[model samples]
Target: MKLAYWMYAGPAHIGTLRIASSFKNVHAIMHAPLGDDYFNVMRSMLSRERNFTPVTTSVVDRNVLARGSQEKVVDNITRKDAEEHPDLIVLTPTCTSSILQEDLHNFVERAQLEAKSDVMLADVNHYRFNELQAADRTLHQIVQYYIEKARKKGELPEGKTEKPSVNIIGTSTLGFHNQHDCTELKRLMADLGIEVNTIIPEGASVSELKKMPRAWFNLVPYRELGLMAAVYLQEQFGTPYIDITPMGVVETARCIRKIQQVINEQGADVDYEDFINEQTLHVSQAAWFSRSIDCQNLTGKKAVVFGDNTHAAAVTKILAREMGIHVVWAGTYCKYDADWFREQVSEYCDEVLITDDHGEIGDAIARVEPSAIFGTQMERHVGKRLDIPCGVIASPIHVQNFPIGYKPFLGYEGTNQITDLIYNSFTLGMEDHLLEIFGGHDTKEVITKGISADSDLNWTKDGQAELNKIPGFVRGKVKRNTEKFARDRGFKEINAEVLYAAKEAVGA
Candidate 1:
């Protein structure tokens, strides 16, 4: 059996908190003294909200953490929450209370009664814990407790007079690194005449929480949250869900087919192949760009991937066959799907290294000595030490995927971006070689060895013959500035006393 762990589900665009906050029925009561790193964690995790102010809160002081300041914790717990008094109040802890072993469970219980709130409290603390487990525990607790209570009250969420829709679960926590994928998936689904009734931690509101029954099935590409959320949706609404990463041509089309099957069974006549065909154009554009022979010299590029398992799988598979890159080492710091990753690795690479932690990944990269790496921000530290260029793929993620859909990672444009960024890094290193060869000073000693401050400057006939060979990033900056150099002024084109005066004007 493939053992899958539950990764923490939220902290995604953190739009889940926002979605909850908007409902007036949601209050995020954090169980930590004010000294907790709320600002930094919130800053690092979510993008949409700055303060998380109206919806998010923590027990007010730092002293409460180590010393268990119950009085202060209770005082801070008093909430005049602006919504429908919240049918459910989610309690999460910061590192302080989590470490101090404070009685947050009782604190929440008493607070509910004292405040006379009709809401239920849930503990969602997952920091300093593994990702999937973090999200899994919280979600399982919520779903099971909700189900048991509803059974007692004879009010099951799925006991409904509903139509049909597919739920897109697992957004907030795990796959939150790159939201463009989710956005593109949504757009693609809509263009194909599919309705996504709920996208948990993103579009799924508490009001819609019970409406999850309306969803005939679940579509999850982010495996961690998908499996856990699928279990929840199945138990509560008896909804069966498919867990798959909607990446690559085959995987993407397969997902559409699975949803189409579910929809057809539910009586929705949709052309799944046509939808996949329409979407193939988006994926194909990137295939053409990335698989182009311009990179034939770079074919069989050796690479090591270390980051989220999902992202590692995606990049390694397509990158290997499409871009002709070879994956020598593959690993992950976050909890993820290894079986799925292994399947891709087996095809794309000769050897695949998998890990659930960072240290092991660093060790693997040092051993493999691959030419390039795609990794988490933390792994970049290791890459820099090893003199390798590592692009951040997962956590400590880069903000380059901004404005969502404007990033083409989902469709053809995304593949193009990948090819462009990777190719430019190496091909652009040729400038120095060209300059050293043509710009005089042969015999390898004067040119490649070292040039003194007093060394006279000279560009041979071959050098002057190639005046404007600069490319890309620094091209415009150098184009306008190069001629201003004294050495350029002394050339035959502008031979003047001003040339000598210009060189003397500044000691270069």
Candidate 2:
């Protein structure tokens, strides 16, 4: 059996719901059993984040299952939310709801009529759909509902722009990266004197979303939202869009100038590199540090990546190009234009794995015997059993207090963090000891020689020599903190001791 995944396309999205729950003016009505909604809360709790925004959810039960109770269910929901008068009510049907072939649209329409509340419909087909679909469906429904509502109310949602602002789509749940990408885009748009309408599925509220049509344009940082919203807007509001994502500095620069061109053909092309450098101020320092540390040690370290399409592509790009690490197998539980990614990474590996199931990815990783892995909780277990070092890059991430747009592995600083984690995972005794004692200390050579002074400590010359073979360019500049354990810190620097520590760490 394979675990399923997908890339989302719309506003009534779980990703948007996930991020929006943290902001005001957001309401997501999960049409699932109570537990499904609770599971979301559980994920947030595990991540130690107050990320999921609380939305009124109507639990569809066995009784609702046995009979076609769409109207009754909608009535109950409307009454509950009508008291507070929610600006927008998101009607999300679960996998169970989808199974029953419930008329979710009709149900929402009835609910809207029954109460004065504006309604948005999200069709979450469980058997066939995953979080990505939920997000896509949600975004679509929210955008459509808002557009119509705005027309009826004669209220155009316009920002400061006298001409027209742009909406950043595909941000909520469509298998997109939240680690600073959104923040970077926001900053970029602001710098351009363009008031971004809102990040759909993240900052845009049901009320605010209703007026989405007024925005002159839409900007999708990722693909799913961009293409889908573009289609919907063309048919409905007739709003146009540009498929643009600001990833690396080059891409960011090209995109900024492209946007300028789209808005005004004669628009002055500004220096995009300057904008990027100003926004990601720490990028230079992080890059210098990452390049100085044990990045060389990570070379030929095989990797297996399983995440969203966009992130997987991003990870492999950085791993192969930036760190000189090898990605043996990479895949996304996401669907998109694989061609773009295929071209960039095809030469790096013999085979590129892309799928929406864990069994397939798990099997692939198991067979490849990679040195490290980057995925989620399940992949961590896979890496553990297979004797590989796995860094969690996807969800079931229980760390919530970590700020958004704070990918330690992104840009320069993030690159440094990635290198450190990788090096730390593979580091062995005496050489590891040397890295510790003198990597950052004032005495440098003296500290390292002193730490390795115990000739009878039983450190392997071969391992130390092999460690030296790693390229200096690949190593991060930041020194490993080894001063504490410099002088025979209780533990011996023998192969057996270090090996034991490594094994115990992963329970291998």
Candidate 3:
């Protein structure tokens, strides 16, 4: 295995934990080392959860390994069932414990024989799947298990809701803006005279999974996590699902139309044209702002987009189609959804990258030098080093991305928030030109101090003087480019000649 300082997605067990912790009175028991228990701390810190993270680790120390792991696993499972009284206990294995090749399913069976609560093994191969895949599969597994159990007990419903209703799937704890997005979705549904039956896996009980068929249809907002469950529901119960993520004004209108069409197909009478028009006219300012002079300034401005599949594809379409920004390239780390992501963004981006390697993503950004970046936290670091303004659109994010304000990345309000993000993320060409000509006070300081202190190469006085002529906002990029150019050519120092040569080579 390779060492990764940062990863686009965590191991498979973390995904299982995310799903288990998302629900009420559902606990997860991970059979692994103590270090693997960090998920609880991360969830508590990032999500600011009021309650304790509903997960436990069956610590696999050297002593346990010398003996066997099954006893410890069974003990933890039974203890959690008794002490926590959870509705369901998800038993999973981490990358470390999977090497032991112990029978985790057998352990679950043993625990279930003694425990009051239901226990199931999250049967995902950590070697084959990553975080997003594991989360999606785990959710599907839980839904299937609960639904089948209810069917066996004759508790499953056989009818849809009397009114138009939908089940919002794939929202869970620690998701990117899930709380705000769910709120906006509810508001949108309420305004359109639609009823929300249930939002799955987030503040939901395991018992509610069997009642999911009550909704007229399902709204799977995220492609990464809920599409599998929706597909399963459609195949089994004939419940149609709308998987369109309404991130921009144009897509939001389309999503509304899709919802109306689905509800009408289910023999319900609902017209959403007035609701759409009203929302576009008053509730959402994105459509209006896109036509304004300020947005016009960004008509042809270039940007690079990279993140998870859902947000990356949605934001790319928004930038290219709605905001009139030129998306130089787009990509995602969700390789499982790469084909779908590429198809979604084909018209917008000429180039599409599908890899989890942050180094490759950083190289691409450096090569393209797009004015703005809409990506995850990794791209945020790349943007800082390259002096490109960036707005985070996906996970692998920092705490600041989870703002206190109502910043939803879905529905009508999301369009407004995204428009603001795009507008503020671009360093306007005109402003840079003016700053260059006016010679800002910070330019000299930046040129002298340089962008990165880790650089070993020295810069000549002549090179520093020449860099000061460039705009202060872009001086860091220029310096980095020059240093890279010099380093490539085996130059010990960056001088005036080296700077000019680097500029010409980069077509700056």
Candidate 4:
């Protein structure tokens, strides 16, 4: 395996932990090294979860490796079951533990005999799968395990609720705007005279999951996490599932109509056209904003989108079809879903890239030179380096992405949030001219700090003067690019000719 300074997704065990922690009364016991327990810290910090993360790490140090890990694993499992008394306990292994090839399934069997709680070993190959894939598989495994148990006991709910209801699947802990999206989805469903039957994994119990098939239909918004379970439910229970992620006006309307059609097919009445019209005309301002004069600046502006499958495709379609922005390229790091993502976005993007490597994504951004970038936190850093504006649209994000305010990215309200993000992400025409001519306060500070920094590569008076002539907003990027160029070419000092040559060579 190749080494990378940054990764788009974590190892397989993180996905398992995300699924386990998303549900109430569900605990995860990971047989891993000490350093591998950072998922708890990351979830606590990023998600701002007040309660303790429901995961226990069975530390597998050198001593444990020397002595077989089965005892420690069983001990931790039984202890968590006794103390937490969780309804379900998921046993997993980290990449390091997976290398040892221990009999984790046997450990689970041993623990199950002693523990009162239901113990299930997560079937995931750490070497073969990443976080998203592992999470999807783990969630499906958990659902199947519980649903089959319910079936054996003859406890599975048989009929749908009196009112049209849907189970919102695939929302879990640490997901990008999942809580807000669920809230928006509930609002949309209520507006359409539908009730939410159950929301899986996030705040739902194992018992609730058993009753998931009772809903008239299922809504799987995220492509990465919930589609597997939805597909299984459809195959087993003959329940239809809608996997549409309603991010833009057109898609939201389509999702509403799809939901309406499914409900009406199930013998429920729904006036979808009127509801759609009311939402478009009153509830959502995105349609109005797109047609307004304020959006003229973005009509033909170029943009690049790179994120997870759902957000990447959704944002690309919104920028291309709704706002009339030109999406130069659209891509996702979810290589497993690359074909589907490409098909979803082929009409909107000029090119589609599917790789987790930040280097390739950065290179694509530099080559295209899009005015705005809608990507992850990694792309935010890339944008800062290239002096391009970036709006983070997906996960692998910082704490700032999880805001306390009601910023949903799912229904009619989400359209407003997305449009605002797009409008603010681009450098408007008049604002750019003004900033270039009379530098803003932050721009002046950045330029001064960049020029005054003490670096090994010396800049001659002529080179410094030439660099100062660049626009303040992009002055730091130019300086950094020129310095990199000079350093690569073995130049001790940068003069006016060197600056010009570096500018041309690096396209700063």
TM-score of each predicted structure versus truth: 0.71, 0.69, 0.93, 0.91
Q: After TM-score superposition, what is the CA distance of residue 184 in candidate 4 from its true location, in Å?
A: 0.6
Off by over 4 Å in 4: 1-4, 428-459, 474-508
Residues 288-392, candidate 3: write the lDDT tens digits.
999999999889988999999999999999999988999989999998777899899989987999999887888788777788999999888877777777999
TM-score for candidate 4, please give it: 0.91
Per-residue lDDT for 206-301 in model 4, tens only? 988888888999999999999999999999998999999998999999998899889899998777898789889998999999999989867998
Our model 2 lands, by Cα RMSD against the true structure, at 10.3
Output the lDDT of residue 341, model 4.
Answer: 94
Instruction: State which candidate, 2 or 4, has the greater TM-score.
Output: 4
Model 4 has a clash total of 0
Q: How does each model score on lDDT?
A: 0.55, 0.55, 0.87, 0.87
Q: Per model, how many backbone clashes are there?
A: 13, 36, 0, 0
Candidates 2 and 4 compared by lDDT, better number: 4
RMSD of each: 11.2, 10.3, 2.7, 3.6
* TM-score winner between candidates 2 and 3: 3
Ranking by TM-score: 3, 4, 1, 2
Per-residue lDDT of model 1, residues 1-508, tens digit only: 1113212122321322333333334566655555443444644454543333344555546455446656655555565433335556665655445666667667777766666443444445444445354554455455455556656786655442354567777665224444576677678677667678777655344545555667778877666554676787687567778775666565556666887787778777777776566556654555555546777777776787765666677777766766777778676544455676677667777777666545566667755656667777656666555545666555544344333435534433345555665665435435445655577423322111011122244434443333334322222223223334545555433223433454355562
Worst-scoring 10-residue span by lDDT in model 2 = 474-483
> Distance (Å) between predicted and true CA of 504, model 2?
27
